[model samples]
Target: MNKFILIAAVFLLTGCPGPMDPVPQEYPAQARLVDNKVCITVPARAGDKIFSVQFGTESGREIYKTFGQPDQQLPVVQGQCLPTFDFQFKPGERYAAYYKLTNPHTGPGKLFAARFSLEKSENGHLQLKQYSRSEY
Candidate 1:
């Protein structure tokens, strides 16, 4: 009886996880064209930090010079690291830009979206859509 009561007390002390609790899933890197900039969403473990985001050609040529400077440390809200920046490219022009998101401890994570383009809506507003992201 004492063992059963102790177990019950332990369970009560540690509350159960509610629906709002964050779950650990396959959190891959993502990208989207917002306004005149390309925004990338990179997710890491709770305590992990994203050092920098680098853009390169499809052939793996570094091209960070073409894009605007990124924020030193992107804001990680709701378990997502959002890093956004502008580039000097035409809207409809197809460019093979590959993104490399780096972490000091975890090496580097990559994402590539082919023919990256952002289209205008009928309302004349730029809409952000989920591009097909293949994690590398």
Candidate 2:
């Protein structure tokens, strides 16, 4: 027991390495209006996981915040999942969505931020949200 304790203490005394440049409270994501649903598809790496996602108003109001972050369980899954958020928007107006990605195994991962705009059709139907990945 004493030897085990000693080894544990030594490990703790050493510095711990943490993930660098983690995603902030918010991210930069975009969505496009398609068939009455807003969709944003980001390619996933092997073993990658989705930590959190949200749809916020241009004024900073969060309409959708998923607590149980989604994860990609299959290691061989090579493509991205199209996470769609159904929304009602006005044409000629814009909105933003945010998403976070991580490595569930390591708890350390990279973040991708993106944005998009909504285009109003002639019939007043809102469609197409577009944006670029940048600092959230």
Candidate 3:
């Protein structure tokens, strides 16, 4: 009975996870146009000191840049470590958002999503969808 009581005490102190606790997932990389800027969300840390994020267009044209923390990067917070910037593009104009994360010790990370487009749509008199990424 002592073992059972000890187990019960441990379980009671630790508590249990709620239904809403989300588990983390991983992906390669991607980008989307939101509002006035194209944001790229990459779940990675700087392999070394000075992580550099280079962005470009579908035709391999330069778009934006971002520099991450030095050394081994800290655990990324929700919605953190994202590179966002503005580029002049016409409506309905297709764009390719590519990024390369670079550090001193490691080479650039691979990029995907080369067929993204900047689009604007009106849902109602005041309801307009700008950004594509939505957090639940």
Candidate 4:
């Protein structure tokens, strides 16, 4: 009886194993400016989906200051899964694009931001250049 009690005490002290931490998943994306619009492309990943996108000239910190809300909230089509999405924007200007992605069975979601600018190419054509991207 004492041996059984000692074994029980050891087991309690060691503690039972708990659930392991989930591995972080990556959702790669790309953005570009075409004509007078900004195009964002996110390849389809297993169990990952983009639900919302926001565009603005402010930084991610500034946008988050406004409770993670931006002036231009792009519409996301429901029930339609597309790799590329385009929205109207002014050329020759710098802007930031925020994306909200989620795994249906996972927790809430994840937020990502990309900053880009337009520059004149050698051929006098406007070109889009992405500066930085962050996941939050």
Judged by TM-score, which candidate is best? 2
lDDT of 3 by residue, 17-121 (tens): 556664333234445444555555565554522233444444556755544545443233334435334455444554544444444545544343333555555
Candidate 3 wrongly placed segments (more than 4 Å): 1-27, 33-37, 46-81, 105-114, 124-136
Pairs in steric clash, model 3: 49-71
Error of 2 at 72 (Å): 11
How accurate locally is residue 65 in candidate 3, as Cα lDDT from 0 to 100? Answer: 50
lDDT of 2 at 49: 55
Candidate number achieving the greatest lDDT relative to the actual structure: 4
Ranking by TM-score: 2, 4, 1, 3
The alpha-carbon lDDT assigned to residue 105 of candidate 3 equals 49
Per-residue alpha-carbon lDDT of candidate 1 for residues 24-113, written as tens digits (9 for 90 to 100): 333445556545465655444443343444454344444452222345544344334254345444343334443343444554443423
- What is the TM-score of each predicted model, taking all chains together? 0.40, 0.53, 0.39, 0.47
Candidate 3, residue 131: Cα displacement in angstroms equals 16
The local distance difference test score of model 2 is 0.55
* Per-residue lDDT over 24-111 for candidate 4, one digit per residue giving the tens place of the 0 to 100 score: 4444456665453456665434565556655676432223222233333333343333333444444566777666766656676666
Which scores higher on TM-score, 3 or 4? 4
lDDT of each: 0.46, 0.55, 0.46, 0.56
